[model samples]
Target chain A: MELSQAARLDQAAEVLPAALRRRVLALPAAERARIEELRLRGGRPMFLLGPEGETPLPGTEITAQTLETVLEMASRSSVHTVLDQVRNGFVTIPGGHRLGLCGTAVMDGKTLVNLRGISSLCLRVARQFPGLASEVLPKLWQDGRLESTLILSPPGAGKTTLLRDLIRCLASGLGCPPLRVGLADERGEVAAMAGGVPMLDVGQRCDVMDGCPKAVGMAALLRGMDPQVLAVDEITAPEDVQAMLQAAGCGVRLLATAHGETLADLDRRPLYRSLMADGLFDRLVLIQQTDAGRRYTVTDGEGRPC
Target chain B: MLKLLGGLLIMAGALWCGVSAVERLRRRVRVLEDLRASLVWLSEELTFRRSPLPKLLEQLARERSGPVELFYREALAGLSQDPEGGLQQSWRRAMVLQLDFLREEERQVLVEVGKTLGRYDAGAQAQVLAQAARRLETIRAQAGEEARGLGRVYTALSLAAGAALVLMLL
Candidate 1:
């Protein structure tokens, strides 16, 4: 079984200093479950970010040593191994929790070489809801094959969450026939792969290529894994679009997400507009943050609401 | 006859003491040499494979024996025992507890290396290890020279003292 939210919180807290871990664990169960991120700045009190807002834990100020310990523990006592990710501004720990770092940058001729003397860290907790896309899944298939669907939302609107669930459902054959899914998990977010095995449940039929650029990973997954569907998260680069177009040419279904609120919002951007113009996506799932919860709306490739 | 036997026993005891002292010196040199060799191996593994510390230590313990192997095993154990203390503390504690035969300066060189083992990039770690190995090499050479010179002196002194004592008794 998947770990409970409290257990995930504990796992994320394992990287924290002992005293701070205790303080975080001491929160009420209600507050613990609602925590979305853990923020720590050297010389400042620790803060817990949730849907309500930031809640500071009194009497728990961060130190430089605390940040060092967190980095050491998160990297499994090997910061050098994850130095590339650290240079990129975040490090994804086991279980897919990402630590966004703020620190002194070591640059070499306009290129970021390393991150040193870390001052603040924002640990974004990764959560999975297995059946989140069940209602939206039926509309995404035509005949026996799944449509090449694009998940659209602004940041923090649960785009990755829905995409993850959709991959799990499709790969596990929860509502449709089992499909072989090759996930180009560029940031290690989708599968949270650790030691050649996924830390999170990405279904039995999923093969993940993690911690590589999405463009390279997608092309590799297409050529090597021979997957029925190629899934990637947060399409942001031109190379990613070219790779998707190449994969589409091979008759492989594609599943991807982009940063936008609506179809019109995506069309405004030249990159996304080119993707839409190529007719690469067969359907779009627009996610909106409603007062009660998230709302997922499905539409055809031409922006006709389904 | 009794007098002769007593003289022989004194001579034998003196010889044993000399041998033991020489052996202790040789052992110190051997320990230093072994530690240097192990550092070279560590440097190669870290530089080429970028292997993590725990796995590298486990491999090291398996390949070595005596104080060098014990040192690595103790370091690995310390990691599991009190992880919050981190690798440096564990490494320093391991050296202090297990490698008592080493001189303070020799151990300090290793402690310096431990401080950076898991903290930096492979290139940096390899550079530190290389520096440590070079330092250990210089120490080992001096130790070897000391052992050869001091061993001969200890043996000659023990033999001369034994002979003088026997003559006086007679």
Candidate 2:
């Protein structure tokens, strides 16, 4: 079978330095296709993380020089264009590939402005598995409309992947009335936008506002786009919860994700605690990576199984 | 007829040597001037825009349009081929290869500029670029002074030598 345009191997290989690229290219074809991330740290062995967990790339040692080369290639030699993302600790390269950065913080009057002495990097492959949300969508929608929904999952459990599919399905009106979806992509993940263009299929009716804070983008979409459903990822900040509440108050449907395994975990966070008690969300979907793909459990706002 | 041909040949040989010597000095001056202008523009760009290194290098390659462009273009190509060498190493290799006419001091200053490039905040990078530009300005002045004297001497000496050779042949 031919490779899809989005997953063309060259895009993934571009971020790697010469030594690492050779190492990655030598992996079996199936293992190469399943690669989700390539993690590099100065003075440590390289690692490849996929669905099968982390596998170390032995005989490879990341160095300060290796990181400099990756930055040069990934940022296209322009540090200014990605300075904001650097300050935020990650950058989204072309082809919708996201690179996470870790280095010494450069402070501008107590606020983190950028990084220096960068020593660790994570190059994540942006893969879209369409229709992953098929089974979970019916639970999110009830009586022919999307309820204010929240998805919960642990880190690396495919929360963003599921969210992307869910947004596409709902916006395409899987079996219901077609509705406009406003995706406030804070970290450029949901839509994986590059040059203001959406790389992943978020659906025909989805309008995205990316590369800004989720709260700010959400508020902007709510005021300007007048979307029927607003989606955001990883709502950990109090400001994001405020924007989500404001969207709920405006009677717009909410679709969002948070870092947690169970509804009980979300109940512990103050921000989510208020959101839960106020009934801002009507449905909760929890995801766990299972042997047979991902397993999702559904419940109502009051913690009752759907 | 044979004597006349010998005289013309001697004059031609003298003219070629003299002109080639003068041209070499003049070319060095042009190189220094072009590099200085490019550095000034780079400083301004680094101050205002603070673009990423690869992007800025591509832009410089396009805008500078000569040996200056060669430096960036070669650096980009080298980085693509051997990224494990680091950005500084790639850039240094370009500078050494492309800026062969440059004095060791002038080349050293350019390599220093690479140290802070793409590795610091805008203010810091701009500061480094500005300093490099200043150093390049001084080197350009030094090259200009040397080129003016040497160019005139080589051209005058060659013309005189050609005339003497022609007279001797006659």
Strongest candidate by lDDT? 1
**Worst 10-residue stretch by lDDT in candidate 1 chain B?**
B78-87
- Pairs that clash in candidate 1: none
lDDT of 2 by residue, A1-306 (tens): 224533444576777876688888887777777888888899999998877778899999988978877876676655666777888788887656779999888798989987778889988877677777878787777887788999899977878888888888878987567899999997777787766668778888999998779999999999899999999988979999889889899999999998898888978988889889889999998988888877898899987888
Q: Which candidate should be chosen as best, given TM-score against the real structure?
A: 1
Tens-digit lDDT track of model 2 for B1-170? 99888877877888789778777777777777777776677677777866556666778788876787798899878866765565678889998889887778988888888776766667777787778877877877877787788878887787789888788767
TM-score of each: 0.91, 0.83
**A81-158: candidate 1 lDDT, tens digit per residue:** 788888888888878888889889899899898876889999988888888989999999988779999999998778
| Each prediction's whole-model lDDT (CA) | 0.89, 0.81
What is the Cα-based lDDT of residue B101 in candidate 2?
74
Q: Point out where model 2 deviates above 4 Å.
A: A1-14, A33-52, A55-124, A173-176, A220-226, A249-251, A290-293, B1-23, B44-48
Clashes of each: 0, 10
Q: Proportion of native contacts found in each model?
A: 0.62, 0.54
lDDT per residue as tens, model 1, B1-170: 99999999998888888889999899889888989999999889888988778888888889998888999999989986766788898899889988887898998999899899888999999999999999999999999999999999999988988888889989
Candidate 2 reaches a DockQ of 0.37
